[model samples]
Target: MTFNLNIYETMALVSLILYLGKFLRSKSSFLTKYCIPPSVVGGFVFALFMLAIEMTGVATINLDITLQSIFMTTFFTSIGFTASLKILKQGGFKVVIFLGLAALLVALQNTVGVSLASVFSLNPLLGLCTGSIPMVGGHGTAGSFGPMLEEIGVVGATTVSIASATFGLIMGSIIGGLVARLLIHGKKLTTVHDESSKMPPTQVGDYNEENHNILSLKCLINAACLLFIAMGIGSIVSDFIQLTGLTFPSYIGAMIVAAVMRNLYDFTNKAFVEKEIETLGSLSLSFFLTMALMSLKLWQLFDLALPLLVMLMAQVILVGLFTYIIVFSVMGKNYEAAVFASATCGFGMGATPNAIANMDELTNRYGFVPTPYFVVPLVGCLFIDFVNSFIITLFINFIS
Candidate 1:
């Protein structure tokens, strides 16, 4: 039997899975410690349930994931809104340096993946499924690029990419602290205590009930309008880019337009509700990820399991060395550099939240160092995606 869900039904199921994931994460120390997204937890469980049913010859379930693209575009568009050059300048030289290192890592990861895939006598594009698409790009980038690779005849690319992303989340969290610990101990690094080094409190998502009640409606409306406008204009932009015989992700144009809009607003002293936009993007990302995971064809992962593991292990080792040698040395080789190395392991393999969590654990144990706190998020959250996407697109065009 095959059961097909309509769009509304699909969204409803995704919502339920997201809530379940949140509940489970709340109850599981491991999930919370690693900063695993709730959607990943719930969606993976649902995927496993579906897999068991399929294996038992019970039923085949199909979800109407039309909204997945919209949600993903919305999330990336929100990220673009955060790419204001003014903020980048405020972060100073370290942010630029960290972003450069991260961009380099993305290229290296794809190169490693492609090289290993050839060694294993697999299609080179399949190698990209385990590359920075999952490692630095996380589940969002994985979900985006997986289907694209599949369309180009890389079977099971989506499943492989999602699985690699999940593995990265675990490994990234595990290794980050270890790398930081090693760096701090090996280098005799100690946190510098200075009142000037304290960072300002973040106001990005401070949605207290009072504040929510006051501004939620207007802010949400404005944010929705901006996202839609950017997405609408971005489709045309994407079409134009494709005319040049280059392949880019569908969301790239929207991201570019959103970045331009954000910088224009920054220069013009126009005010928009950034907090509401970020919250909406977070919600969209959860839905998009849950839908992507729940729709995964888990059976497709079987044949490539060993190769996937080899590629992912290679990535883990690469990130460890890159952080220890390159990131540590380039970022001043001090206490802040140690912390930065730890944070790099986090976002290098997973997402910005993982990076922040890694830094938080380190700061809790030692004293707080403000430089990494300021620079890491600025680069990791706002800038790295642009660099990663550009590099990945170049690789795709070249490989194709």
Candidate 2:
């Protein structure tokens, strides 16, 4: 028998799963120590349950994941909102250097993945599924490109890509903080102030309910308005760009629009609450990740698990060496480099949230360094996708 879930029902279940994951994280010391997102924990559990049932040939499920793209786009758009030209300028050479480093990593990941896959006698194109397509591109990119690969005769491409992303998410979260920890302590790096200060002001703000409740509401609404406008205009831009025969993710246009909006808002000296928008972005990311994990078709990945693990391990090793030898050195070999090293692991294998989580955890332990807080997100969250898309395309054509 087949069970189908509508979009609303899927959303309801996702929300519940998120809550359950949060509860479990609070109860589990291991989860807390690793800084695992509740959505990942909860969604993985559901996926495993589904896999068990499917393997038993008892039942199957079809989930409506339409909202997943919407949430993904929304989350990325919020990242764009943080892309103020002023901040980028203030970020100085470190931001430019790090962004260049991140872009180079995309090509490197594909090279390593494809090279090893050839050594393993696997299809070279299949390696892309395991490479930056999922590693740097995250689950969304994995899902988007999976079927295209399958159509070109790469078997189980979607499954391989998704599984790689899932593994990346967990491994990224686990090791990112550890990398930063080792670098910070080993190098005797120091923080200038409390790490919490690196967070958006609203996150740390204490407001009297009577005086600030209305203000808070207004801020949220304004953020929503700005996000909606960016998304709306972004869709049009994405469609127009597609007409030119060069494809991009829907979120790319939204991100560009948001960046422009942010710079404009900053230039005009407009009053806007960046913290509230960041909060909204965080919310969207949680929901999007939960939905992505919940929708995984685990049965599709069974045969490829061994190869996936081998390639992913290789990817991890490369990431570690690159961060330590390259990212740390280029970012100045200071306290912020340690933090950026952690962030590298996040988006290098996982996504922006993982990178942020990695940085947040390390900062909490060693104090906050603002450079990583600014540079990592701008590079990983905003710029990397554009560069990654181009590199992935180049690899596809090269291998094909």
Candidate 3:
């Protein structure tokens, strides 16, 4: 038997799964420690259930995941909003250097992945599933590029990418602290005392409750409008890029358009409600990821399991060494560099949140180091995605 769900049904189911995932995360320390997203947890469980049913000859499910693409585009569009060149300049020279290091890692990751895929006699495109697509790119990039790779005739790409991303989350968390500890203790680096380094204060008292609610609503509406506009224009941009005979992700155009709009606003000194846009993007990402995970074809992954494992293991090793030797030394061989190394391991193999978590753990255990806190997030979250995406696109076009 086969069960089909329409778009509304799919959305409802995804929402429920998200709640379930959140509840599970609340109860499970392992999930919390690893910083796994609730959508991933819930959707992965649902996928597993579907896999079990199929294996038992019980039933199959077909989900109308039409909204997945929209949600994905919206999230990437929000990321584009964050790509403010003005802010990059404000972050100063270290941010640029850190971004360069992160970008180099992206290239190295693809090189390792593609080279190993050849060694295993697998399609080089399949190697990308285990490359920066999952490692530096995390689940967001994996979800975006997985389907693209599939369209390029790479079977099981989505499954492999998702699986590799999950693995990265865990391994990134585990190794990040260890590497940082090794650097700090082995080199005997002293912690810096900077009590003045803290987050800037928010303008919370400017609006009363009624006015605040009204403002929030207005901001949300504007954010939605901007996202749709960018996405609409981005389709044209994507088409234009395709005219160049290069394969790029569909959201790339939207992201670029969004970035341009953001910078224009910055140039005009106009107030943009970034928090509202970020919230909207987070909501969209949850839905998109949930739908993507729940719709996974797990059976397709069986054939590529060994090669996938090998590729993932190699990536973990690469990230560790790269952070320990290059990132630490180049960033300056001090306490801040150690923290930066840990942060790099986190985001290099997982997500920026994992990087933050690693830094938080280090700060709490040792003393607080402010430079890494500032520089890592700026580079990892804002700049690295743009760099990684461009590099990945080049790799794809070159290999294809």
Candidate 4:
């Protein structure tokens, strides 16, 4: 029987089954639960598995790059949908200041990545990919761009993306709490507006006043049609934009189209588009991140050396200060708003989900959000990433 076991496939099955088991067991809390963010554990454990198997000359890892692309695209669509242009409107100068500082910090972060790679005698581009590019930005950005960098000759981009995401997840939760508590003590503002509640549904067009069946085929049809239309229109417009000799990330173009379509739907009072999009997006992100991580080739990193680790440390320190002192202090309105802004800053510069997760943990534990949860999710999932893509391209070109 040819003893075939694709290492990544095996690891994915193992990780998912393990995760499901823990879920079924009703385990709780990030601190105690064996859930150290499924991606991190999945990727890490899988790498170890591959190392063991490969060393014995038993198996090799094969990543399905095409599937990775699809999942990554869908995930980015979700990220784009979550952006809230409204809050950014109200935020005005604060948003400007925050974006500017964040842009500079990310540039510094890139520089730090290059420097670290040089120190470790590894490719500097690889350092950038794993350091802050994707991991901190979450699965959407990291996985979406990993293969692209790989095409550009940056090896081990996937692993670095996973590692960065793990670090971002950890830092996001901690920084959120610490900032919230500090703001309270410093008397920077009054009243925390975090209402620890479920993330509300996206605003649909008209609430059908006539209470109808929840499982109606029409509802499902409407939801599916909306997504289809959004996807279709988004694709056409994005292509047109690219055809015009301008460069934009694939997701950004899709999101602008989606957002525009959504706003237009709102005007026509038929705005039920993107309903349950999050479910689809989340599922895609989970699998995408999983596949991206499952093909861990640890042996490749044996030559990475120590200089790279120091560069990462420097970048982390820089981001921390940039977030705390500049972004938080200057963020807008009351203390609660500032905290949210601080967290948002992290998301724009780090990971959007991490941003919402941080805010979610904060509100869940504390209790007051002046800005609204939907706002953050909207911005994180949609608008910020679009903006970040543009910003990144600009930064790259400028540096080059």
Candidate 5:
């Protein structure tokens, strides 16, 4: 029998999984110590269950994750909203340094991926699918480029890309926290939140909302207005740009729009409550992640298991070495660098949300550094996708 779930049912299931993950994490030492997000815990467990059922030749289940894109887009829109020019100015040289390094890492990921594919006598394009396409690009990019590879005669491109993205998501989450922990303890690094820090107190979903009635309502409406405007105007911007024959990701226009709005707000001294926007973005991210994990068609991954494993293992090692050696050293070798090192794992391997979650977990344990949070999201959300696409296209052409 085939079982299907509509969007609302799927969301409800996702919420249940989140709650279960939270409960289980509360009971488990390993989960607590590692700082695994509740969504990862629950969504991943449910995916494994579905995988088992498929392996057992039981009923096939499919989910209508239509809402996934909406949530993901909105989550990203929130990141765009957070891109305040004043904060970027404060981030200064370090932010630019990190962005350059991260762009280089995307190229290296494709290099490593293509090299592995060549060594294994697999289709060279298979490595591209497994590389930054899935790793740095996350599920959305995977979904986009996977079929393209398949159309060009790479068998099972979609399956491989999706599987690689899933692997990266889990690994990124696990590794980011561990790396941060090591840096914090080994380097004797700690942070104390300063009111005068360069970071605004607008962490996604975190704020002092003691006055949750009138203020929250007003702020939510304002944030909603701003986000919707960005989304609408951003689409027009994207369309206009595409007409000029220079293509970009769909989210770029919206993000650009939001950033412009944010800076304008800063310039005008408007009371744009960033905390509410952050909260809304956080909620969207949680929903997006849960839907993404639960919707993984693990059965599709069975055929390419061996080769994909080799590729994934190589990618994992590369990200680890890069984070510890280059990312840490170049970002200043301080407490913040260590945090960025951990967050970079997420940036390199998974989506921005994963990177943010990693930072959130570390900050929840240690104190907030704030700088890395601002740096990672801006790079991960705004710039990485732009650079990654170009490099991936270059590699694909070179390899093919």
Candidate 6:
């Protein structure tokens, strides 16, 4: 009844509740099926409950902003860790092609955003930001960078970015799946082979079980400390940018610095706990996404529902068309590569896990991965973000 309990208290409560629920099998069939990431679902659902309480004059929206920031920071720190250069090396030129296709989609996404904004007589510059990057880029990307857009006079920019990212996630999921299906139907799919053509196999059962690897508490702590350091460095770069009369999103620099640190550790073979890295990262993303979605101000969405729906529809159509026509053709119509490429754009232009899940759901049904699992995440989480930022910036400037 009392809402004054701090985050640690809240986290303990949440963990206990979840554990109890799991013990009771209290989760919904839909939830279990989607395996909805708790972060996104939990955060979102909790936020809405807060909103509902506010509407009923029972509570205020003091969203423990500090706690929110920490959760977001952890989520992105995981992102930076997962962005290791080692992934690209493992993935090889498949990584290169994924980046290339993502580059093009970033350009196309802005074109869609700006052009659509122009039709509605809104500021085209703001339109570009609210499109896929911030919207699809998730809360860290949106929250960190959204304020800058507001400072530059983009009204309701935060809301717009959140909405767009949510829409992007949905679109990415659908398009990624659709693209994979089409690819499999059109041609024989191939596994992505590295130069090592003789890639070593992990011990048997290391497949999805890789997601369950345990690591030392010390390593987790070390990784957390490194992420905090990255956040500090991100603040420095962000501050410098603000002073220089140039702008970028808030979390971008932090992610970049953290990514650089992650890569350095990986390259130097400086030991860091990375065994369960991918799984933790994926789980973090899923939860973050679920939380973000559950918190949706359903009312805010009600009025703009028409516009939001239009934007959502247009985004879906555009992403699909591009996936089928442009991406497939450019990637030499290699089914696996096309599937991966479309997913990169789908998520970059859309949602992270949506992109990955899109690929996975299709692969599972077909009984084969059209592309390497590592390929989509490598580009979506790490490489494509930088390119999308550059491309989105270009759109904003071009319209201005």
Quote each prediction's TM-score.
Answer: 0.94, 0.79, 0.94, 0.73, 0.72, 0.77
Supply candidate 5's per-residue lDDT for 222.
85
Backbone clashes under 3 angstroms, per model: 0, 1, 0, 20, 0, 23
Instruction: Tell me which residue pairs clash in candidate 1.
Output: none
Alpha-carbon runs more than 4 Å astray in model 4? 1-40, 61-65, 81-108, 115-122, 130-132, 179-217, 225-253, 332-334, 341-353, 356-369, 372-375, 396-400
TM-score of 3: 0.94
Query: Candidate 5, residues 63-92: lDDT per residue as tens digits?
Result: 887877677667767877776767667777
Model 1 scores worst on lDDT over the 10 consecutive residues at 201-210
Q: For model 5, give the 10-residue run with minimal summed lDDT.
A: 205-214
User: Model 3, residue 42: displacement in angstroms?
Assistant: 0.4
Residue pairs with clashing backbones, model 3: none
Clashing pairs in 2: 195-368
lDDT of 4 by residue, 39-77 (tens): 545556666777888888876545434566556666666
Q: Write the per-residue lDDT of candidate 2 for residues 1-400, one digit (tens) a residue.
A: 9889898888888999999888898899777654466877898788898889888989988889888877888887887787776876877887789888888888898998899889888889888888898888887677656766777798778768877887787788877877777787688777655544554322222211123423388789999889999999999988887787653555768988998998888999997678788778878878887877776777877676777788999899888888887988888788888878888998898887678777767766667667677677777765676678778877876787
Q: Please write out the lDDT profile of model 6 over residues 1-400, one tens digit for every residue.
A: 3356565655554454344434333366544333333444455555567768867877553322334445555566566666766867878876787678767766776678778777777677656655656644655566544555668787656566766765565556656766666675567656454213443322222333234666777766666677678888887977887675556556666777877887888879877666545444544544444334433455544555565567656766777787787777766677565656556545755555556555555444443453546666667666666666666656655655
- lDDT of candidate 1 over 81-195, digit per residue (tens): 9998999998898888899999999999999999999999998988888899999999999999998888879889899899999999989989999998898888888665432
CA lDDT, every model vs. true structure: 0.88, 0.78, 0.88, 0.57, 0.76, 0.59
Candidate 6 residue spans exceeding 4 A from truth:
1-26, 29-35, 50-61, 86-90, 134-136, 182-211, 275-298, 341-352, 365-370, 393-400
